[model samples]
Target: MILNDFLPVNKADLLKLEWDYLDFILVSGDAYVDHPSFGPVVIARVLLDAGYRVGIIAQPDWNDPNSIDILGEPRLGFLVSAGNMDSMVNHYYVSRRHRETDNYSEGGAMGKRPDRATLVYTNLIRKKYKDKPIILGGIEASLRRFAHYDYWDDSVRRSILFDSAADLLIYGMGENQVVEIAEYLNNGIEVQYIQHIPGTCYLTKSLENLDQYIEIPSFESVKNDKIQYAQAFKVQYDEQDPIRGKTIVQRHSETYLVQNPPTMPLERARLDWVFKLGYMRNYHPMYEAGGGIPAIKEVKMGIISERGCFGNCSFCALAFHQGRIITSRSHESIIEEAKMIQMDVDYKGYINDVGGPTANFRHPACKKQLKVGTCKHRQCLHPEPCEHLDTDHSDYVELLKKLRHLEGIKKVFIRSGIRYDYLMHDQEDAFFYDLCQYHVSGQLKVAPEHIDETVLDYMGKPSGKLYGQFVKKFDQINKELQKEQYIIPYLMSSHPGSTIHSAIKLAEYLRDINYTPEQVQDFYPTPGTMSTCMYYTEIDPRTMKPVFVPKSNKEKAMQRALLQYKNPRNYDLVYEALILAGRQDLIGFHVKALIKPRTNVPKAGGSKKSKSSKRKTPSSKTSINSIEKTKKRR
Candidate 1:
């Protein structure tokens, strides 16, 4: 409510706060939202708590070099981040089309920031203050800190530090590294010499005496050879732990890129302190008259109870950015944050979410993970749950119980992704029962991704039969509780190994259930995901086997259309997809059919005849069971 509640955004703010120069100036690609959900704000607050002056420059004009001159040069250096979401991912879609509206900007406007925002902002800062240390962090720099694939360029590019010529690149949750770097810089250590820190990457002219570091294929080799690129990705993926991980180096042209091992995750108390460090918990007032940031509406009432995830789905970037080891906050911390929500004007007695990357995972998958790090060759939840895998949800259930009974809170929800396979793996059903009773807001969304065995294998997802079992259990619980809640399964269309036949199979599953997903996810080959590596190499890095990548836009469209077969608008594409897959058997009037015959197509909106979609419907549970039974019989 006051001008000083948020960090200083411009010269006027610095003047109002009576500051002459900032100790650290953070350049971001998002609207200035002083909330804990935004990474830039967290880093800034951490720096401020360390007794340093910090200011922010959000969405600066690329054309006007003076736009960054408002905050003036910092005494320590300038910090660069591409906002919470990657800028390129924010600006364009999987189809490479520009998104019409920006959720992180004022008025939901697009083009307020440029593509590859970290590089742009770093270059802008360098233009004003040459030789000043430029530190790169956030998802953009974190994922692309090494030689990796760029979907927009369709080629492997050098590290952001290499391309931007920045001094340091801090990856992962950067609270630990940011404060360390600040103290070192405060003591007058050169940024170039600050290379030994973990969870960071830097460039060097020599790799001598660094025998502890593992050397991977160089930029030239990976860019030209797909196999080598896959190998490099595997090394990076396996060696991301702070405990067991070693330093990794890759050569680019003449210089070498060194990525120090990941920083140790914050303990419960540190995570609690980070979240409780006086966040405004809202977007800046400058945007209130301009419709405000749409992204804040989703997380303003939400609480991040944990960090990291062991559900290492290959398509997800969490493993690369947040690692697989789980770190969580304590009950008191989360409950206090929940009370903070009551102070919001928009609080309606509902807590939007209370989980992080994966909702139910509160601790490491096993006892050994915290000490020795994750196994290099095996995953906790892939192929099969590890023998030491722990599936206890008592902590999370208790947290929600305390929150549900809070004075002003009416309902507490877990909107974050729930690993159904992990949840069902539990021996007891207490958390499942609690989840259904307290968390179900008419529907629970889970990501089974795809049902086809081969695609699921490539995606590192559990077998569809497991999802079916989970679904059955979900239905039984909701029914027993007398709640009319439905399971909204998040389905994906084209992934690395998903062929038209595979897509047709998923469409058939949807047909069998008589349910259609409201939205479809196409596999996006972002910079730092194993699936993206597979997408580029056409080979699964884990097995070194060939994968069928659906790259054609038309084929992807057809696959997407198959998911919405009931819509008359998708008839043509769905018809073509089924025909191409030699699935004419699924194009007829049978109850198992995915689409109507070509002759039965309506002229516009939808169907008109009694033979249309308004026909008799079957029980969704029975239909899903039938699907599993058919798969088993086949």
Candidate 2:
């Protein structure tokens, strides 16, 4: 239980370790928490286990030049990252307003790190030590390796390596890539010669020997034309697999940006070894007086049983970052971690979660994924399950059963999102029944995203009819078990293809179900997602088809208000949206009406209105059959 067992973060710690020089100095935007959930910690631990000396510098002052000099220079090079999240997304909201809290910081404080953190940190290091090699890895660097649209600046920018002046950019999960790069560097190989490694991006004077690689549109073309940008993103999206993926190259003004194929997925033993490292499982003791790090609470008791995802939602970045191949830990590895949790002094007989990107996904999508990789043009679960998809849940079910029966463990909940579409694909009912009986804590959260068929199609999700069938099956199982469990759905507003009419349709559906969501999430256009491309260019990247995007603040607000029309504050916006959508007939006082008409009341000096002031309404039927079908859930 020694607190000093964590990575060296200061000069004193380096002195204690008796190391005169280190191989790599890792810089991160988040406060150092030596848990597997944090990206910097995982990469640092992997490098450390490879017999290389590593030190860390977290959240250094960007205004002062001497802030990054605490840890002297490393022997080989420096590793730079912007922590678990992208710096811009961590600092600002969709409205371009600064956020009040930073979840990855101590005490939930803000202003810890600067914007474009990878660029800032790399430049800072370059200012002090101009000749040293600097390598960038993490979400901020991986997604920005190509010329991407900058939401904050409202313009397309060149590759981050050009701005940051870093030697190499390691994309995706960089366990194998980092080790290979380190081994090459340690053996006296220069950074210029390290471009041939897989999962690394670098700038070249020409595409001389890369005729076999797939050439994308140049940066200048995409920066000027929105249609070309969509085409470029489509080419990038289709070639992310490790097996059949080809090396991709894009041209800038004078240089070419070459991105090698993704690194191979981790095998069972390698995945287990990475998680079994000596993680402190909490924030460093120096931050204990500041109430510790808030981000650690999310995974302190939760076990990441797997990695990668096959459910490629259009709005999610997992496909680009973690890839669409699923890799998991052995059951013995998971049980060993759970046993460690049972020994905690604060153990309350509860395990928060036992899943990764998607909880139920334990292995690759199918047998062919191991050899040929995932399909380049189609997704495994989107639109419909592939004919070759292996949808067995037996391994997950057996693992959960063993965890719940442990001596000191009490309730085990699956808080991570479960893919209901995949669950329904399974022919057996054992996993579904056991999930309802054991894993649920009164409510199970799922994401159907939207009910409109057009919007669902744009979202890369199944139709609403599939969700209806799943809901019916869930209710039937709960009834048989005599439990009062509920399924709370996560819905989104103002996604691509969702027009004013579509918003009104969602509002009417909510009214019929007699349910209201407390909060609604507006679709955020983060980098490296198919949906974000549509949001910025008004065209789908996959098919280059025109899409309806809600970009104005007023339009986005009105769409969000329609989801929560029951709130008195949203009455005006909802009323206006209904009128604009040609649904003014739903303004009267009736069971099918969405809102009441705006009427003037008597002021201090005015007279009261008569009963005739209320508008007369006629009985109407609004999707009564759909309402009856959904009555069991209520």
Candidate 3:
């Protein structure tokens, strides 16, 4: 595919196609990369396949209105997105420091897109064409369709609809919503009258009585009180199902934000058609001068066989953004994509990844999920796997088996993530045995998050015992297969429920395992997540119970340092944290001690305590058992 083959970005390309005006113009924060992994490209291609003239304006200059005028106005409307990721998250780190590089931008440079790209771009477009129908989609808009807690501002903000002033907001996977909105506009219907489309949110002046709709707390109430915000979030969370979900309404002063029920998840055939949309599968040549996008490298050969996740970790936004209902393509569809991947000029024997949010999740959690939608208040795999939960991985196992045997494919690895708790629930171990025997490339990565049960409870994760059982089972299976694969468990520090004591306990657990993680994730409170709500409101929305949150930088640093207590640089923080937690016994020169006693003289006003005469030898089993007992008691 040449440059002209791509959707026109400027007047010259439009002239080549002999089109005076486009049906729709897409404005994205990311550089144009016509790949399925990129949301903007997928929406554009879907529109184009529907026989609409779609043009793109990627990373337009927010500083100048003329930059948005390059594509002029579309006959249908404007589709605005903050690229594949939330703009604030893409541009800044948890520490509120500007990121040095943006993988979404050309050459991995910074500042190609502005902060709050959707809001900024929409305002710019409105400045030029005041009456054009502007629609917001992508992660930023999808997750913030309701009133949300904005980490950058440290305050609760109103819905994106009020702020962006866009006619409609398409949340979740927008393939279904975008098409419906386009067709409505194409039929000469005004954007204001197209409010009833599923998966789309629109502003309204009056509340209409609809039996199928539920009303959440008004924005004024949430803004004035955090408790109201949490309550509102719970109501919104309960109505996300496509099969049985109801339209949600929340008042913002005189106007209202009415979110229609989510669009039904695409079936196998529709999903296959979307993936086979003849994507160029590469960055546009326009980026050749600035070096092609680096983000493309990670996903160029990866296959997203499924969409959505049922492993709804509280910290994750997938449930709210992608919905909990899992939808997957057929094996034939995936195999065909993999065959195309093999023919790529840069194709290697290895396929990067073969999964979605949760790689092993091929279908809904259970048979009932398809009929009744997901259980609103209950979870499928947390606490313990529900009896109705489906744990079969035969389909996934067969899919992987076929991929590995495909010509020119040496190894097909599952790099996305595996829900260990879900994997452990499988009674028959065919998938487990196969994963250990074939799929694992030496180490299988998993997210245990933390070792403390109290912290795990607040995280909506299973108990530490489940993770322990999984670790033992993984080792047992590996041993049975005569394989030497290791488990690289992902750990998080300074999460909402984590205190100094919890951090110290986690550190001690790491000491017993004789492993210090090279990387530790400091809890990031992004918008539209239960964890973020807790970080802001200091209350669990599900139970409305107060939660202990680690908010201070010093406290957070201590927790993060404890995860890497083995490092010499972290010795002081580790010792300080231990003392603060009343675990100073873990600071002496002994096998059980997390850190050795300071040899240097004490600083001013600092007192030293005498060392214990008797010290018990460190035993991994004893330490692990003690932690487990503590969890049980809690």
Candidate 4:
């Protein structure tokens, strides 16, 4: 493959192809990494396979209108996306501080794309092509399609379609929606009139004759009344399925934002086909000097074995974007991708990852999901596993064995979450044995966000007892295999239901395990999550009961400090937190004490894990059920 093989990024390449006009120009926030893992590249490839001429404008100078003119105007339209991640999340930390680097940009540099990139890129396009159709897709637009709270702004905002002035917004995976859109636009249908497509949101003046849609609440009501906001989010959250979902309407001022039900996910064979599209599978060569795109390092060798997630954690946005249904590529498709990895000049004899949202989930949670759809208000493995839930991982085990046996493949690692709760539910141990024996590198990472029952209930994770059971089994398996491996449970601090007491309990558990977390993720209330609804409304939409949200920055800081109480710098805040919670008993010199007393008061000596302690994980019945965001995978 040569430079021309990749889609044209500039007019010179278009000239080299001897093309005078283009069909669609994809403008994205992320630096172009032409691989299936990137949404923009996948959409562009899908369109190209459908025989449309496509060009990409990646990380163009947003301030310069002429910068986007490099590709000129396309005959069909322009596709605008915030790339794989939400732009604001890409640019800032949860604390609202500017991030030092942009993983998606070349050299991990910040400012490659502006904040709220889809809106900015659309505006840039409008400056020159006033009448051209501009369509929005990707995580940013998908999650922000309806009127919702904005974390960085700390206020409710209108739908992105209303604010960005784009012609239409594709809310979910756009392979099906974009092709339908391309066909309509190619047939000379106006963008404003292309309102009937599933998974597309549009602005309307009247609801006349639109009797099949559900009107949750007006933007003004949701913005002014917190209760209304929670109720609206609940409706939006409930109707995400393609089978049972209805058209959703939320009015903003005089106009209405109408989101059609999500498009059905691609069948397994078609999903397999989409991955085999001719992709360069690397960042553009022009970025080589700047160390290529840092984001690609984790994904370049990994294969997206599946899409969609049934393990819907409350804080995760997958249920909103990918929906609750699960879909996967065939073993043949994945094995083919691994062969490509073997051919790469950068191959290091290891497959970085072979997983998706939940690696072990290769199909729908149950056979009923294939026919009717996912139940709106229920989860598969949280609270308790449903009787209908499928726990077989034999197919996954077979797939992994085939991958390990491939030529030039030294080891195949399962990096994308393993869903240990789901694994524990299985009666057979083939997958569990294989996961420990073949997949694990040095350490296996799992997310048990918090151990407090109250917090775990709010988080929709399995019981703490379940996590303890998983840890025991993991240790036993490693022992049986005679390998030294560790389980690093991803921990969270200051979530909606967590209190100072809860934080202390989590800290005590860490102390018992003799583990010091190198990094902790504070709760970030981004849009499209039930947790964010609780954060803003202080009420659980499901039961409409009062939820205790740790909103004050001071309390949030103290909770975070409690998670890392062993650090010398956190002594002050941890001391204050302990006193406020009336738990100063934990500050003494006993081995069970969390921190040392101040002023050289014969301070509590740091304790080591006894041999028996090393044999087990923290004993909080549900302490290590981490609800990891898996932010890097998408």
Model 4: per-residue Cα lDDT over 1-634, one tens digit each? 2232789999888899998988999999999999888999999999988989999999999988899999888999999999999999998899999999998999998989999999999998988999999999999999999999999998999999988989999988899999999999999899989999999999999889587989998999999999899889999999999999999999999999999999999999999988888888989998999998998888988999998998878899999999988999999999999999999988999998989998999988999997899997788987888889999999999999999998788999989988888899999999998999999997999998988998998998877778889999999999999999999999999888888778999999899889889999999998899899998898889888787777766778888999999898888778777766667899889999988766432324656544433442122212211111111111
Whole-model alpha-carbon lDDT for candidate 3: 0.88
Q: List the residue pairs that clash in candidate 2.
A: none
In model 1, which runs have C-alpha deviations exceeding 4 angstroms? 1-4, 600-634
lDDT agreement of model 2 with the native? 0.88
lDDT of 3 by residue, 1-634 (tens): 1222688999999899899999999999999998999999999999998888999999999998899989877999999999999999999989899999999999999999999999999999999999999999999999999988899999888999899989999999999889988998999999999978889999988775455678888988988898999998888887889988888999899988999999888888999898988888899999999899999999998999999888889999999888898999999999999998988999978898899999999988999988889998788887778889999999999999999999889988888999988888888899888888877899999999998998998888878888899999999988887889999989999888887789988998999989989999999999888899899898889899887777867678778999999899887667666765568799888898999876565556767533432332323343334334434445
- Residue 577 in model 3: lDDT: 67
Off by over 4 Å in 3: 1-4, 209-212, 601-634
- In terms of lDDT, the poorest run of 10 residues in model 3 is 609-618
Per-residue lDDT of 192 in model 4:
88
The TM-scores, one per candidate, come to 0.94, 0.94, 0.94, 0.94
Error of 1 at 240 (Å): 0.9
Clash number for candidate 3:
0
Q: Model 1: what TM-score?
A: 0.94
